[model samples]
Every structure is written in C-alpha cells, then in structure tokens.
Target: MEKAKEMVVGIKELSSLPAVYHQVRGVLDNADSSIIDLANVVSVDAAITARLLHVVNSVYFGLMSRVDTVSRAVSILGMQQVHDIVLATSVSAMFKGMSPANMNMTRFWSNSVMRALIARTGAEMVRAGELERFFVAGLLSDLGHLVMYEVEPKLAEQAQMLSVQSGRPLHELERELLGCDYAEVGAALVDKWHLPPRLGAAIAGQIEPALADELYRRDAAMLNLARIMTDAMEQKMESEAIAELFDESIWTLSGLKPANVATIRLIAEMNHGEVVTLFFPQLRPAG
Candidate 1:
C-alpha cells in the first residue's frame, strides 16, 4: 500500500498538451470544419506542420511525390487521418524526453503504436466507424500504465511482475494490488486531459466488455485483438491461455476468422518496423 501510494503521488500533476494541438483538435472535432481550417490551424505550428508533411510522404503511405504543406496533406489524407497524424505527432512531442526510470518509454510507446495500428487495421476490416478516433483510443488504452510507472515505479514494476508470474492480465493485477486498475487510471487521465468522453470511457471499460457502449465495445474488442495479435507477432506464449480473452462473440464480431487472424498476425510482424515508424518516429533513433 505504501509503495503504491508513493507511486501515485510521484506522478506529475500537469501533463501539458501543446497549444497548437489543442486548437487543431478542436477544429477537427467541429462537424462543419473544413480542410482550410485544418491547414490554417496546423500551419501556425511550423514543427507540427513539418512533421505532418513528412509523415504523409513516408513510405508507409506510399505516396508518389512528397507533400510540402499541411493543405496538401489534408487534401490527400482527409480530415480523420490528418487528425490522427496530428494527434500522434503532438502527443509524441509532448511526452518526448520522458525520464527513462519511469518506464521503458521506447518499448511502452512501441507497444502502443503496434497495438493501435493493428487495432485500426482490424476495426477497418470490419467497417467500424470513426476509424481515426478509434485508432487514437486504441493507442491510448494503456495510458494508465504510464501514470502508474511515473507515480510509483517500484510498485508498478511489482504489479507487472505479478501479472507475469500469475498469468493474469495487467489490469486485473492492478485492481488486486493497486486498489484501482490501469483502465480506471487511464480513464481518469483521459478525463483530466479533456479528451473525448467516449475515449476515456472506452479505456475505463476495456476490461468489462459487457458494460461498454457499442463504440467502446468495438474499441475494446479492437484493442483486445491487437494485444493478442501483438503477442502472437512477438512469438510470445502461443498457448490457448491467451486465446481465452477473445471469448466467442468478440472473435465473431471482429469478423476475422482464425485464418484471417493468422494472416493479420503475420502482416503485423512483417510490417513491424514500418508500422512503428509510422506511429512513433523517436523510437527509431532510440533503437
């Protein structure tokens, strides 16, 4: 209890969002917003604009020519995708240079990007709506762990060890050991950050599939499969134990048959490097 309390108290109270990002995300959320609105908002931030242009032209998207401005990027990528890239880049920049002792920042973000990409791919495979926001939700689903690690590194480490030793999921171990789990913590973080309410709820409700809204249910399902698919891609324990998380309905709803699951897993692995770079560029330098 002491250790966990220490961890919780140790985290920074203010996780600042970049001003330009806040402005741009606000514009993106407005239904009547135009591409010119995005271009104007993003153009004000030179660094963000540069990053956006670079990402759109990256080999992952396979554009024939380079993009030089936010307007061109927005025209080609559309609003949702532009929103996703901006969010990812902005969030990455905000959290960059996070202290090494708090967490393996590289691996933590790498896992997040991998899960997010896989989830986005899986969700789109089934025609899930709000695909871009869903991708962001999937990326941030495990954000509670960042707080835990920052607040109480040792206890968070213990909880993680417990998860491994006991073969229970991390969230379950968190509830037992930390009084509250990462999902709740993550939800709290989301609320504090003033993100979309549904995004926070999905993170909060990820462990309780039955209670989640349709979007959250789909969001959780995407994240769940992504985690499993990542484990498979990494060649972790290929046991049926991990497969139980799928249950019956989740698998059927995802519309990925066992064969498709295998194919997706292979694709995720084969494209790991490109996928990681697509989401998190800083990691490549670290690696």
Candidate 2:
C-alpha cells in the first residue's frame, strides 16, 4: 500500500487537483465558510460554474425555478452539496486533455457514469440520504486504474489480461501483479486530494466495506453493490454469475433489497448517456 501511494505520487500528470478546487476546499475547511466563499472561488472557473448551474437546473434536481448564478445554485443546493458538485466537476476537469493512447477514455467514463447512477439508486433503495456522496464515490471509484495505467502501463495491462484469462476479479489479479488494487490506489489518491475522508473511505472499501471505518461502511457497501451492478449492466458477467458477484453482506448491512436490482439498473442505464455527456462531453467526438 505504501509503495502504491508512492507510485501514484511519482506520476506527474495527476500530481494535484486544480487550483480553484483547492481554493474552494480550503474555504470548505473553514467552519465559517458561506455560499459567497464558495461562489467567489468557483466563479473563476467559468466552465465549472456553468456546469454547476446546469446540473442545479437539470431534470436530475428538478428545481422549481431557474438557477442562473453560482450563488443561487449554492443557496439552493447548500454549501456541502455545492462543494460536492465542485469536487465532482473539478475532478472531471483534471482528467481532460489526457488522451492516453491505450485507455478507452470514453468507455471508462461511460462505466463511471453508469456506476455513479446505480450507486445513487442503491443509496435511495437503502434510504441513505447522502445520495450525492454515493454518486461521486461510484463515479471516481475506478480512478486508481487510470493512475496504474499511466505510470505502469505494461504491468497494468498484464493484470487486466490475467483477470480476463483467469476468470478472477481484477482487484485480486492487481494485488498479485501490482501489490495493490485500484481501490487502494484510488483511496490513496482521494486522500491526497483532501476531499471528504468518507468519500475516500467508501472508495477504499469497494472490495470490502469492512475495510472502512464504521461511519463510512454504508457508503462503501453502496459503492460495492454499484460496481457489481455496473458489471452486470455492461454484460461483463452472466445473469447467473451476477448474483454471485454481489456481496450478500451489503444487502444485510445496507438494507438494500435484491428486488431493487432491475429497477436500479434500468434507472442507471436510462440516464447514463445524458450524465456522461454532462460530465464528460470531451468523450463525444466532433459533431
């Protein structure tokens, strides 16, 4: 784990979050932080501000009135919600212009968006109120693989191939091949970013919620279920095999019913394309 963290640090491309992201975070760290403080820092990035308002006004939120300004968006969503939006937006932007030749960036983002939506549905099924956190956690859960493919493409490729060849989970193969899996790498990177600790924790525990502290277990469980459902949705696993991949403990721990599986997948797939376009329009080629 220590070596994996060090490897992530050595990668220059993902060294830091955007400046505005850090600035907003610094204000968020201050208890006296207000909507104005968030608006001040976020407005500097016109693109983020625009997306923030768009999402605030989108069918996703279903707001009754127009939200034309970052301040109005912040007031409507509250500081914490706005910060999560900023975190999601800035994190998405950080990966822009990174056209890694080997990685299918579009497919990667599609899977992420799908996972995020599925996670949100699962959160709702389980009655977890922190839906945005669940969405962000699922959206970024696979990011560690990006770091691995960036810094050690050959080894990462080997691990991916082995998973397909051996019929074992990728995380298991990653441990054997790289000494750490995407969950650990993603968690370490999230921790380094200084976002919410539980976000990092939930991602870190995607493979096993018990790996996270008690406070974050519910979110972690939600993330784990979402990943499994994404695999099932993408046909990465067979219908019969899908049930096997589910962590039964998540059902017990999260109160999310298996009966909700079809409904969750439907909702995730329904909005996935739109959500992908909203968050990563770069993935779409020239129209």
Candidate 3:
C-alpha cells in the first residue's frame, strides 16, 4: 500500500482533481454557499457548462424540456445533483490523457460509464439513497489500474496475462506483482482528490467488501457487483457465464435478487451506447 501511495502521489496527472472541481467542491461544502455561487464557479468553464446543459437535457435526467443556462440548471437539478455532474465531467477531463500504452481510452471510459449506470441502477433497485454518489463511485472504481499501468505497464500486462492463464483473480495477481491492486491505488487517488471518504472506502474495499468497515460494506458490495457486471459486459460474456462470476451474497447486500441481475444486466447493455454518448459526446464508437 505504501508503494502504491508513493507511485500515485508522484504521478503529476493522478495526484489532484482539476482545480475547477475543487473550487466547486468548496462551495458545495460551505453552508453559506448558494446555488448562484455554485453556478458562477461552473460557468467559468465553457466545457463544463456545455456538458452540464447536455446532461440535464439528456434522457438520463428525463427533464421535460431543455435546460439552457447554468443558473436554470442550478434551480432545476438542485445543488447536490449539479455538484455530482460537474465533478464527473471534470474528472473525465482530468484523466483524459491517462491511457496507458496497454489500454485504450475509448474502451476505458465506455466501461466506466457502463459501470456507473449499472451502479445507479443498483442503487435505485435497492432503494439506496443518493444514486449519483453510487454512480461516481462505480465510475472511478477501476482508477487504480490507470496508476498501475502508468507506473509499470509491462508488469500490469504481465499480471493480466497471468490472470487469464491461471484463472485466478486479477487483483490477486496485481497485488502479488505490483505490491498493490487497482482498488488500493484507486482509494489512494480518491483520498488525494479529497472526495467523499465513502468513495475511497468503497473503491478500496470493492475487491473484498467484507474487509471494509461495516457501514461502507453495503456500498462497497454494490460497487463489487457493478464491477463484475460491467466486466462481463465488456468481455461480451453471456448472462449464465456472468452469473457464475457473481458473489452469491452480494445480491443480498445490494437488496437485489438473482433474477434481478438478468434484468439489470439487460438494461445496462441496452443503455450502454447512449450513456457513453451522454458522458462523452466527443468520443466516437470504437470499431
């Protein structure tokens, strides 16, 4: 863990979230902050404005009409939701160039968006509060892999190959070879970014939620299922095959059922392209 922390901290790219995100977060944390204050901070960045407007108008939100201005968006979506949207978009931008030689950025973001939607779906299905928080946590769950690949691409590749050959858990191979897995590295990055501690806790314990604190285990369990579901989708695995990969107790933890997995996976698959387009309008389909 120490080595992973050192590696992530030393990397310029992953060390901090974009400054604008921090500024917005400052207002979100301040009791005196108003919707206007948050709007002003967001409006400074044209890209975030466009993305925020696009998202609020997108079918994802299912707003009746277009939301044209940041101020209007603030009034409509409320501070909590807007903060998440801006942070999500800004984080996407922050890691825009973090693709390792071994991984494709298009595929990376696509998987993240899928996992995020799946997590949100899980949150709704389970009646877990704050769907957006689960979405962001799921989106960032795999971030540690970016740091690992950046610090040691060849070793990362080797771990992947070994996992494929051995039929063992990849995180196991990653920890054995790299001194830490993506979950640990991701947790470290989440801490450095000063995100909600739950986000970090969930990421850190995703591979083994049982090891996390009792309170966070529930959210971590949701993320764990979301990750497995997303990976199965990315690999184009069938539902039965995916079923074989699930933790029997995770469904219970998520307040879902075995049958529900099929439904959630189906919905996630159907929505994958549109959600990808929703978050990454600039990206084209990876053919």
Candidate 4:
C-alpha cells in the first residue's frame, strides 16, 4: 500500500545485509547447519569477523580465552551466540551514520544493546531456550519506532510528544494518531529482510502482547521484560500497560522472580556505560 511504499522509499538509512551476513542468516534458519558453516561464512567477511571476535572477547561474553579466530570463537560461544552477535553487530553498523531527527542513533543503539543483553540474561536465568535469538528479538523490538522516525518525522515527533504528555506508551499513541505502530513497521522490515520468523513475530507482537504466536510468545515476554528492565534501570517510568498485558504465569513459566527484578535493574544500569563497545571497538574501555 501507500504506507509500505513510503516506508521503502524513506528508509535510506537502512542498509542491505552483506552477502556473508545473509549466508549466516540462511545457515541459522536451517536445522542441519553447523558451526563450520557459520565459520566459513564469517571467514569471508574480514571486517565482520574482526568485529565479531572483538565483541565476543569483550566484557559481554566474559570469555577468558582471548579468542582470536572465528572457528575458536564459535567453539567457545556456540553457533547461535555468534549469530546473535552478527545480527546485532550488522544492524548496529547500518545505523552508525544515521541520525534520526529528534532522536540520537548512538543513544538509541545504546538502549537497544542494553535491552538485548538484559533479555539474554533474563532468558537464561528464567530457562528460556535459545537465549541469543531472544536477545536479537529484544534488540529489534523497537525497530518500528526507528522506521517511523525516518519515514514520518513530524508524525513521529508528535506521537512521542503525546506519549510523554499523556503518559501513554508511544506505540499505542502512534497507532491512534498515525494508523500504525512501530512494532508493525518493524515486523515489515524483518519480513523484508527475510530474517527468522521468530524475530519478526517478536517485534510485531511486542506492543500487542496478546497477538504473538505460540512459538514466539516467550520471545514476546522476554522482550516485554527486557523493556521494563531497561526503563527501570534508567529510572524511566515503567510501562504499566505492558506489565499488566502479560500474565504472571508467563514470568513464572520462564522462571523469573519478583525479588530479582531490582538486582537485574541495577546491573543493567551499571552495564549501560559499557554498551558502546558492543559495536564500536575503538570506544572500548582500557584495562
């Protein structure tokens, strides 16, 4: 439709996935793919491989081995963990030079990395399987909001203003005022990019917790809790609507506890200062 066209045309900041990254995605989607397949794909892209290695050895993974090769890194972190890192590193690169109006891409990506890390930690703590994909889903959950900023700055700004003034979630206000929310637009991007189905579903269903498919319901909850953790850590107001939207049983099923919420929030806040290195190696702190 017209909206789709506008989105495609206006998203000049969005970059196409590199060939190696595309191959990595393919291998990730296939059940029979192995670490050697990922290592082969990663080896072809020296820049990505370097960045991937840098990220893996960084404080994020806490690897004591000082990994220097893709194969060894894969052995240490597993194929899926590398996939999540590639996806995050790739997307982060695309947004480096992109300065959205009324929004800072650096800060935006910082917030995203924080959400992803928290989601992964929360998933592991709560026994959610495939923690890495949940991390990627958490990272991309807000992608629609980015698209809105690119495609319709005026409307995006207005929606943000309204959300702030009315204390309503931005996605809800965006749907009311603009006929669509970022979650849907983000889902469209995921489809366009041909990412894993779980990622698309997770982004699309983030705002509307009830609409997520059974397979991605856990992803939705992970993203939901990740967002809350992010906001609570930043001392921003928590999304009461989102908190109430997902049932307590989901959290219990995931093995999360109310008592640990404060601990996670504090750790996430402390980790925020290190987030820049999740992408920019040159910005990494000195030992």
Candidate 5:
C-alpha cells in the first residue's frame, strides 16, 4: 500500500487531473452552488465544454432534445452526472502524452473504451441507475496499469510477460512481482486525485467484487464482468466462449446472465470505435 502511494505521489504532477476538474468538483461539493455555477466552470474550458455537450447529446444519454449549453446539460443530467462527464473527459485529455513505451496506446485506449461501454451496457441491462458513472468507472478501471508502466516500467512489463507465459491473471502476477497490483495502484491514484470514493472502491475491488464493501460490491461486480468481456473480445473468443468465461458469482452480483453477454458485447462494439475516436482523436486513421 505504501509503495502504491509512493508511486502515485511521485508522479502526481505528471498524472494530475486538469484544473477545471477540480473547480467543477468544488462546485459540485458545495450544496449552495447552483447549476449555473457548475455550468460556468465546465463551459470555461472550451474543450471540455464541447466534449461534455457531445457526450450528453450522444446516444449515451438518449435525451429527446439537444443540450447545446452546459447549463442545459447540468439542468437535465444533474450535478453528479455532469461531474462524471467532466471527470471522464478530463481523464481522457490528461493521459494524452503519458503513454509508456511498453504499452500500445491505441489498443490500450480501445480496450478501456470497450470496457467502459460494456460496463455501461451491463448497467442498463440490469436496470441500474446512474449508468454514466458505470461508464466512467469502466473507462478508468485500467488506470493503474498506465501509472505502473510509467513509474515502474520494467517491473510492470515483467509482470505482463510473466502473466502471459504462465497463463496467470496479470493482477495476481503484479502482486507477486511488485508487491501491489493495478487495482490497488488505480484505487490509490483516484484517491490521490480526490475522485469520489465509489470510483476508487470499484477499481480497487474489481478483481474480487465479493471482497468489496457492500455498498460498492455490485459496482465492483459490474467492472469485473466488463473486464472479462473486454479480454474475451480482445482474444476474439466466440460468444459461447465468452459466456463460459463469466463466473457464476459475478453474474449473481451484477444481475447479469451469460445470455446477456452477447448483447452487451454488441452494444459495446457498436460504440467502441466512435468512443475511441472521441477520446483519442489522434488514433483516428487518416482519410
């Protein structure tokens, strides 16, 4: 735990969330703050304003009317949802230049976006509220790996290689090799960044949802399934194979069945390309 803290602290400046995120968080934290206050903070950053409007207007929200202004978006989505969107957009922008040599930025971002979509889709299937939060959680779930690769590239690479060669879970190998896993590091990073505790808890306990606190156990379960689905997609496993990969406990925790995996994957895939391009435009191919 200390090691994880140290790593995050060491690279705090390099990995810090943008100032606008903090300002928006401040407004959200204040009960006295008005919708206009939050909107003003978000709108001040043109990039975030544009992206936030795009996401809110996108199929993700499925609102009947368009949300052209941040104030309108705030009014419709509420403070928490607006905060989630800002955090997601801010995070996407934060890591633009921090890709480590050992990682494929494009593939990494693709998988992250896929995991996010899968989690969001799974939440929708289960009738969960605050579906956008699920997407943010899924998108930021693998953040520990990015930080690990940056702070301890050699050890991180070794863990990955060993996981592949031994066919063991990467997080398990990471624990043995680095005395901490991506989940822990990721949780620590969010904590360091002053993100909501729910986000941190979901990322930390994603590997074993049963171990997470009761309040967040279901969220952890959702992320666990999302990771499985993302990995299965990456490996090109068939739908039956993907179903076979889900644990019964996870299905119970997430209120999802193996039968739902195909639909979730389809939804995630349909949105994957567009989201990847939205978050990481540099990856879009030349026309």
Candidate 6:
C-alpha cells in the first residue's frame, strides 16, 4: 500500500486534475455556497461550461427542454449532480494528449465508458441512489492501469501479457510482478487527489468486494460486475456465456442476477459510443 501511495505521490504533477475542478470543489465544500456561486465558478471555464451544457442536453439526461446556461442546469440537476459532471468532464480533459506507452487510449476510454454505463444501469436496476456516482466510479475504475502504464510501462506490459497468456486475473499478476495491482494504485491516486473516500474505497475493493468495508462493499461489487460485463462485450461473448461468468456471491453483492447481464450490457453498448464521444471528441470512431 505504501508503494502504491508512493507511486501516486511521485506522479502528482502528471496526474493532477485541472485547477477549475478544484475551484468547483472548493465551492461545493463551503456550507454557504449557493447554486449560483457554483455555477459562476463553472462558467469561468468556457470548455467545462460547454461540455457541461452538452452533457446536460445529451440524450442520456433525457431532459424535456434544452439547458442553455450553467445556472439553469445547476438548478435542474442539483449541486451534487453538477459537481459529478464537472469531475467527470475535468478528468476526461486531464487525460487529453497523454499517450501512454503500450496503451491504446481510444480502446481504454471505450472500455471505460462502457463499464461506466453498465455500472450506472445496474445502479438504476437496484434503485441505488447517486446514479452519477456510479457512472463516474465505473469510468474511473481502471485508472490504476493508466498510472501503471505511465510509471512502470515495461512491468505493466509484462503483467498484461502474462495475464493474457496464462489466463490469470491481471490484478493477480500485477500484485506478483509489480508489488501492487492497478486497483491499489488507482485507489491511492484517488486518495491523493482528495476525491470522495467512497470512490477510492470502491476502486480499491473492486478486485475483491468482500474485503471492502461494508459501507462500500456494494459499490465495489457493482464495479467488479461492470468490469466483467465490459470484458464480455470486448470478447463478443453470448449472453449465456456472460451469465456463466458470474457466481452467486457476485449476484448477491451486486443485487443483480445473471439474467440482468444482458439488459445491463445492452444499455452499456447503446450508450457507449455517445458517452465516449462526449468525453473524448478527438477520438475518431474505430472501424
């Protein structure tokens, strides 16, 4: 764990979120801060403001009327939802132009968006509150791998290759080879960033939700299931094959049955392209 924390500390400058995000966070942390105050801070950053409006008006939100201004959007979505959107967009912007070795940025983000959508859909199925948090959690779940590829490209590549060839879990190989897995590294980064403790807990416990604190175990389990569904989609597995991948514990922890996999996956696939483009417009659709 110290090693993971150290790795995050070492790359603090490289992984830092934009200043505007911090400014928004500051407003949110203030008890007296109003929606207008939050909106004012967000409006200062033209790029964030534009992206926020775009997402607000996107089909995903399903708003009856278009939102032309940040303040109106803030009123409609409430403070927490707006903050989550800012965090998500800010994170996507942070990774722009970063081309990590041995990592395909396009494919990585694609899978991430799919995972996020699946998690969000699953959350809705379970009537889990804070649906946006689930989306952000899923989107950021694999962030440890990004850090690994940046800080330890060779070892990360080796672990990835060995996982593929040996048919072992990537995190297991990462633990053996790199002394820490992507989940730990990612959780460390989340803690370092001072993002919500729940987000970090979910990331850390994703590999083994049962080991997570009971408060966050359900979230961790949801992420684990999301990753499995994303992998199934990538492999083009049949619904039955995907169902075969889940154990009873996974179903219980996630509050989802194998029967739910197909619907969750379809929701993810349908939204994947649009959400990916919303976050990463620079990425051309793959052939």
Candidate 2 residue pairs in clash (backbone atoms < 3 Å):
none
Off by over 4 Å in 6: 12-15
TM-scores of all predicted structures: 0.86, 0.93, 0.94, 0.87, 0.94, 0.96
Lowest summed lDDT window (length 10), candidate 1: 1-10
lDDT of each: 0.72, 0.82, 0.84, 0.74, 0.88, 0.90
Find the number of clashing residue pairs for candidate 4: 0
Mark the regions of model 1 whose C-alpha exceeds 4 Å error after superposition.
1-10, 100-102, 235-245, 284-287
What is the clash count for each candidate, in the order shown? 2, 0, 0, 0, 0, 0
**Residues 157-208, candidate 3, lDDT per residue (tens digit)?**
8999999999999999988998889999999888888998988999998988
After TM-score superposition, what is the CA distance of residue 60 in candidate 6 from its true location, in Å?
Answer: 1.8
What lDDT is reached at residue 287 by model 6?
59
Ten consecutive residues with minimal summed lDDT in candidate 6?
Answer: 6-15
Better of 2 and 4 by TM-score: 2
lDDT of 1: 0.72
Report the lDDT tens digits of candidate 4 across residue range 1-287.
24533575567556466677788988878999888888999989988998898788778677777998998988888888888889888887766666777776665676787787777777777677777787788778777778888778899999989988989988778877778887788887887777888798887777545567877776776777787667654555454433443467557534676655656556666666665666754333422
- TM-score: the better of candidates 4 and 5: 5
Error of 3 at 1 (Å): 1.8
Query: Model 1, range 246-271, lDDT digits (tens) per residue?
Result: 66766754665544565555555565
Residue pair clashes in candidate 3: none
As for model 4, its CA RMSD to the true structure in angstroms is 3.6
Q: lDDT rank, highest first?
A: 6, 5, 3, 2, 4, 1
Decide which is better by TM-score, 1 or 5: 5
Candidate number of the best TM-score: 6
Q: What shift in Å separates residue 242 of candidate 3 from its native position after superposition?
A: 2.4
Candidate 3 global lDDT = 0.84
